[model samples]
Target: MLSLKKIAIPMLTLLLVVSAIGLTNAAPSTQAIETLNIGFMQAPSSTGDFGVRLAIDQINREGGIVGPDGALYRLQVVYPNRPPFAPDGVPDAVTSLVAQKAIAIIGPVDNRLAFPNLEVLAQAEVPVLTLATTDALTELDPSDNIMRIRAADRFYNEGLATVLIDERAITSFALIQTDVDSTEALLGFEGILVNRSLTPTVKIQEIDNSNLQADAERILQGAPAAVVMWGPPEDAETLLLRLRENGFTGLFVYRDAQEAVRSGAIPISLARGMMGATSWSYTTPTELGRAFLVDYVTSFNSIPTGVEAAAYDAVWILRRQIEQTGGDITKLREGLLQTPTIYAVQGRLEPSTYGGGDFSRAVTVYTMGDLGGPQLVARFANNVRLGDDDLVATDVRVVGLAGTLTYTPSPSPTPTLTPIPSATPSEVTLTVPQESVNLRAGPGTEYEIVGQLQLGDTATVIGSNADFTWLVINHEGQTVWVAADIVDVFDPGNLLSQLPIVQPGTNNPGIEPGQLSEGIDLTIEGVVLSPPQISPGQPFTVQVTVRNLGVNAAGSFSVSAILQPGNLTITAGSTGLGAGQSAIVTLNGTVDGTGSYTSSITVDATNAVLESNENNNVFPLTYVSDRPILSRIDFVQIPVGTAFDFAGGTADMIWTGTQIEGQNNARFGIVYAGAFEAVDYNAIDPSVVINFILPGSNIGTGSLIGFITAEGRRGVMRVDSLVGTALTVSYRVYSN
Candidate 1:
């Protein structure tokens, strides 16, 4: 039942007409209007609100909905007094919405909040649109009133497995579950692997309770080709950073990567190339999805997250049902169940009969792009369960409404190259590995075909065209160029750098006489410090490897090591170096203090050598001495009683960083320092005794606290936020 009100403007106009007709006592006619109250139970700052609000505004602007009673109805969004994170928030919020006679409600997005209050919601007899991915929600809500907007955990897991295993051909996988909340999700992911008759190379559960450093080491020891991490955003960020720090350069697929990157818990630089699955992405391949992205960004002045897209779709879903059922609360649920598949911004959404209403079964697999956010890799839909033999690969190329997105593959690990000292300069050669390759007169195909080199044929690489895309080689003493991609160039000592840049033309195919006569090019090959990490006031020797990468031999030149912040310069004289020859020159320097400094090693610091490329002479070296190099972690959420290790960059039970109310005489307690920016790491006096205590009311957002770690390393942490049981902080720690 809903309340109806008379139209004031129509009643007022009728009264005026009656008075003009000399019938003042006649009853004035009126039209009734119905009010449809929809409750939005979420934090105002949540991104979900953006979509909900946008949908409501658009509906109201487009002349509202017409009810079954033949009366016009307007949608009104009601908010609860407390957000979902507040104490007794879910139950209280549901009670408030029910009392307010809200026919339907949106959110309590978190599974933890929604699952416990399922009974309260069911008893209220209100249709709810939930964003929770837990499959347990369907079982708990037997009434079928709660419809999930986002895809279930099983669908997301299956889609992720399909993308990684089937599409990418990832054989070795390591699975890590950091949050207990993601236990079912992790199982679903593992189930896919198990169903495929495969097991994860390594599985780590409850990583939050264990040492992350040791776990990272264990993962590295296993050496899986890719790591699939399932956890809360904060935990994912911590684990990801640890993995990268431990030099695990393999592919990383994190479930919470989107939220972590959006929240700035991890920088985009760190998140780049990471893969994840979502119900939707801004880079959705559908035209409807692309239009939604443009409209959302235009309205909000920012890109919408997956939660926002789901929430927006939820509002529209509710509106569609209400329009069909004409505001009848009893008919709305049936109408939703009978509703046809909706082409929504997320994907085609289908109503579930098995108590899992609006089960879209659509998931997108994306890899984070360089600057454009998530790039689409593959999309799974229509409850496509991928099997070993019957795999459906739907890799999509996403073209946004604004522009086309080029999906760049994840970067491979850089190969380490070791230069072997040779008595004679190493010769650079080009070999045709496959079919016969044409030897062009010039660098490009535009030139005439001079000759053809057969497969397995080798040639000496004498020079290259300007861009190095074509190599000029001496095949049987005949000068010709070959496409760089068609032939493999072997230059172990990088002797190709010494080769002359040949000018290619239609008239002249061979190298000109004056082109190869350029003077010696001196370059700093490598710089090796005596100790990688030095102590304060310690003398260190810098071994500078100077190489003559030119056609001619280089005369005597001085190599210098200039250490910054100390302005200490040490120079060593080199006898000389022949073409493609390298000489090690030693220069000694010392730093008087503990800090980070840059060492600039210049092979020809005084311009003593006339080289082909003067820019290649200097090589910059950055190293830290005795001082703790500060590592920054931003907006990382830690629950109460949890300990965070700033040095190790992980949050666990171990009391290394400050805990909310840690034990051990509050060894991990934090003392309120001044403003975050005011507390300088280098200026913090070790002598100033800090009284560490449990965080109080004064230690809310924007408050800075200084603490000494268990290892006696000092650190300063700024409280980014304190919401209920969760405390988010950004911190910088130094090595003692």
Candidate 2:
């Protein structure tokens, strides 16, 4: 907004004198033509001003402000050279310019400052080409003295209003902005949705610039599908950093990002996704402004100021006005009202015939590409082209109705991965070692052999030191040592050597089961050779045993132990020390899951597969077949604390047929309601729960059975499906 209020008095005199004299300075045949002083009130520190300067210089060199006689009117620029000013001083500066007789004004460079100068320029009836956004300045029709070639504030926000909704496929916009000018502009975007009668669920998170944390908390709570930061670079950048740090991963849009990108506050990678709109991508560029940009880059190897293109257009507007008007102020005014319609710096404005004010508001929405560079993404066509009164005025807000929303249950199954097996083992055994073995200083066979042993060599395997086996061997005529793996143990060594693992306990950085009351120091115990690899929030196993020191009934007692899959073994025995005595049971070896999984050892743990120990080697736990099993579950909410209402025992329950070789009917069930919204099957975990604890809540039981279906799924899970294997199941509960 330009204001020549201070210049009102003195500028009136100059205008009147000029009107009275009609002193059109004619070109002297002898040369040394007179000049025209164009008041360039732009901030010298501003990039837009430099652009305007370039255009001014180029025109002067090419015979500027071509007069009625065709003589070049040299432009003397007066960059507001005054120091910081109090209220009174600002007017003094403008009035001083009027006294100097500047016929027209270019800019004060910034939009906020543009208005003060507008008061004076508009007073002189001199049109000021503002290289900034904010249509309100022109909307005021302030003497028609303000003609903006550049877009105003709401320009980019409005463009993104559609772009984000479309390109990003977002139906929800979280409006997080500084509670200021941009905030209103962002909120102003609601009108766009309303005009289309489309209500978008918009949540507002007004970030307090001073408190980054509180702002971040408020935004996260807003649960916006996308955040539109409606503020300047300074505030937005700070908020963006906090948002990222807090892990609010989502899409973000910025209104003005030049400052943000160059600030180094927002990391470059994060800035790439940013989108914004601006009146001037750079300064003083005209229809051929892009060329000037390229030239500027070639010369300086950096991006020019944001206002550069606008400044370039400003000069072009001046030249075209002077040229078309035949140096007549009236003709120049008419051209300002017309041609340069599209205001393109590189190409002629798309339409070329659009009238000023409305058409000059043309803006090209841009996306921020790599390294904060700008790329034109789209240009909204004129509202006139709509050709219908159906369109409402821009900037209307406060619709009566809010947006709507719906919750669709996930159609495809929720993504789930086989939690890394509850067990990962570094424990290994070599069925056979090199016939002859060399013992080295380290556990590896490749280590330098410190001694040797032969085919008949005898060695006692203490235990595996690591992935390689450690052993003490007897060499002919000498005592030597070697890796048991290298020595070829006929049977695996006792695995207890790795037990009692050094572990974090009860305090911090330890297992949840181990978390005791706070303040106590976490005492690390011995490292267990094998810890089960298990899913977080899933039941894993740990084993502990107490020897019988007293007599008790033996019909069917239960004992519990976490399956030490790492040790690959379990142990039990009657030490038989005495009825009132005890001995170390040394729960020993077992082979099972590769990770730490907790399984209770029931004296009658009931579903124990009831097979003899020999069957451990006979059954592979998970068997491969021509088909695979795939089962999916849908959950309906159940209120907490209510007993599961499974169908009564009187009802007949049915087991869907299972094609998996050993899968029996009794292993699963689909009761009306059970514990949680959990659907389990052999495909994910093979432990067939052959026995169930009948619910006391109702005098019955319930279950979910997995039986065979179509082709099946890939066996990466267990067996390959496309390779002739994919079995699925549908289970429903029947009363037994």
What are the lDDT scores of the predictions, listed in order? 0.62, 0.40
Error of 1 at 118 (Å): 3.2
**Which digits, one per residue and each the tens of the lDDT, describe model 2 over residues 37-147?**
555553332456556655554444323344555453555444443311222333555554555555556655554455444455455545566664655656665466666
Best by lDDT: 1
lDDT of 1 by residue, 196-299 (tens): 88899899998363566677878898999999987666666777788888888999998667777887877898899999888888876565466667667765
Off by over 4 Å in 1: 1-30, 207-210, 352-355, 385-736
Whole-model lDDT, model 2: 0.40
